[model samples]
Target: MTLFSPLHLREVTLPNRIGISPMCMYASQDGQVSDFHVAHLGRFALGGAGLVIAEATAVHPHGRISPFDTGLWSDEQVPGWRRVTALVAASGSVPGVQLGHAGRRAAVREPWRAGAPLDETDAAAGFAPWPLVAPSALPAGPGHAMPAELTARQIAHSVQDWHDAAVRAVSAGFRFIELHGAHGYLLHSFLSPVSNRRTDRYGGSAENRLRYPLEVVAAVRDAIGDGIPLSFRVSAVDGAEGGSGIEETVHIARRLAAAGVDLIDTSSGGITTDRSTDTRIRRGFAFHADFSRRIRDEAGVPTATVGLVVDAEQAERLLDHGDADMVLLGRQVLDDPNWPHHARIALGDDSHDSWDVRYGSALGPRARTLARLTASGETPLTRFSP
Candidate 1:
């Protein structure tokens, strides 16, 4: 099946379409990786994800959405990331990193905490939330501080940060890199009119709104050369009134595809305060399935459909039906990192012998039982035993 086929881009080859969605561990200290990151990511690779994307990594100190967010802004962070890439690659999964800048969403409290906007007191205590920068001075929430409007010079610098981060990602042994243009982050903020109300060249028209992000993608392509694949994760809509629509996203995706982006990781919403609509389609649901297909058909760029995509049949049918080229599992992968291994069995590949020898002895019987149960429409491996 196309879903299980190898995805070849440049010199980078994903062994399978299964990708570990970049999930923030929030376990870093001063933007440095700890043992938690190593173990957390390493296990997913071992569990058989073809592509393991490290969590959203901030390109600058203040660009972090929270104090615990990982960073690739400094040279010191590369060594910590190297440990992760090495392990993932050793497990045969191509390791990648998602480089991002949180923009107006930056410097907030960690999710486990209240996630309330951070204040000067927090910044002074070393968890300080600095004034976030965005295309407009929009605050992400009521209590969130209104961000300072980024000047052209600062915008240029921000683009440079993305370029630099791409270089650092390669140095850290990542074979693939994706720009975090999704989920109301920096690039998404610029794309959505609700968040970017600037009259400058970086805003106003759709072309203007896409200028900054396109420049960033171009810069990253220049830095990383043509050997590795670069992807862009985009929030296909703002979900607020007058927010960007799929027609606009298709235009952006077309340009990005021309500018050397390999795949478009399609996700949606997060520009405005409208979480109601966002919640309705939270699971592996692409808001504009037809639109995504149009992008792949017309623009000819491979797409990765994410958000609430659960189960092998749904993922396989997505590719089988021509909706997207790949399926990215986020929370589902978290729920079971070995989902791919199980999926391969369900699809009748007969490669059950490919399970890692370390775990193969036990997995053989377990895979048989799971596949048999799954055929009967029951899953007994919901909770794995250590």
Candidate 2:
């Protein structure tokens, strides 16, 4: 199948294989989405994105990555998200949301501020640092505070929170739900031995480490019902010393598939905060292809490859070669919200018919005029060139 092909996942059909990867805008106010979010996310849908997944929305307020990150913790947040989903759906794109808990990564500043953990000075400035939680009482890095270990009761409550958030996501009109089980967040922290040092049922052996995330997947799956597609994003490899590898991730993927995860959005690294100690995989075009392909084949689950997937040909090649079932674009789409439509032209469909009528009607005549000018051996820049 080509990049433009439709992907039928459960009861939902994505209009095309190219999906907008959830990239945190960090523009919310106390977890409430504003008009900025509606305008920001709506553009991709208007620009021809087949699926638009909202950023990592915290299931609980304490799980926020930054004070400004969006959340779905209460009913008040539903109406705002409903506006986004409604606009996206009206634009002929499937709307999805990623529910996440940042765990020890919480209470940090935005990426532009170097993502440093907030402290008293920031608290005085009204950006107070909240207590972080994890499976073990360990800091994400040297300077970060050691997070409080989550009690069994608290862990159970967190699972319920995910379920509640999934219900809210459904109420907000999202057809797909993804659980953020990656990047050294709460679920990934529990899965990795490097971050999790607990001796309880939620830690230790690989199967034990799989406990909490599986519970979350099951809870979310049940909450959203069997009709909506459920996706799980995983850091395919920890990319750090003593971290889990592909084989371990494969095991996790197999369990996740069994637990009702439909797609694995393969990503890597982010397990540790220390840049020096953090080992990163090669940053190449479609960097996650091998990881995604392996998970798709070995785990027998559909996969979506991210990381440097910039163009249509590369995305099509990945799917054609069985590297992934879909390709997710993050920064590329940010650079050009209409990249999907542009890709159609790059792939030889020059009619611009796929574009929304408002854009196509205008652009179509301009494209023909340019072609006619070129055919007549007259260039628009010929008169200006020295």
Candidate lDDT values, in order = 0.84, 0.93
TM-score of 2: 0.98
Could you estimate the TM-score for every candidate?
0.91, 0.98
All candidates: CA RMSD (Å): 4.3, 1.0
Stretches > 4 Å off in candidate 1: 120-125, 274-291, 365-386
Candidate 1: tens digits of C-alpha lDDT, residues 259-367: 9999998877777544543432333254445555777887789988776677777778878889888777788878888888888877877556546778877877776
Model 1, residue 136: distance off in Å is 1.5
For candidate 1, the TM-score is: 0.91
lDDT of 2 by residue, 1-386 (tens): 38889999999999999899999999999889889999999999998889999999999999999999999999999999999999999999999999999999999988998889998888999999999999999899977888999999999999999999999999999999989989989989999999988898998999999999999999999899989999999999998899999999999999999999999999998888978778899899999999999999999999999999997888889999999999999999999999999888888998888888998999999999999999999986899888
Model 1 gets an lDDT of 0.84
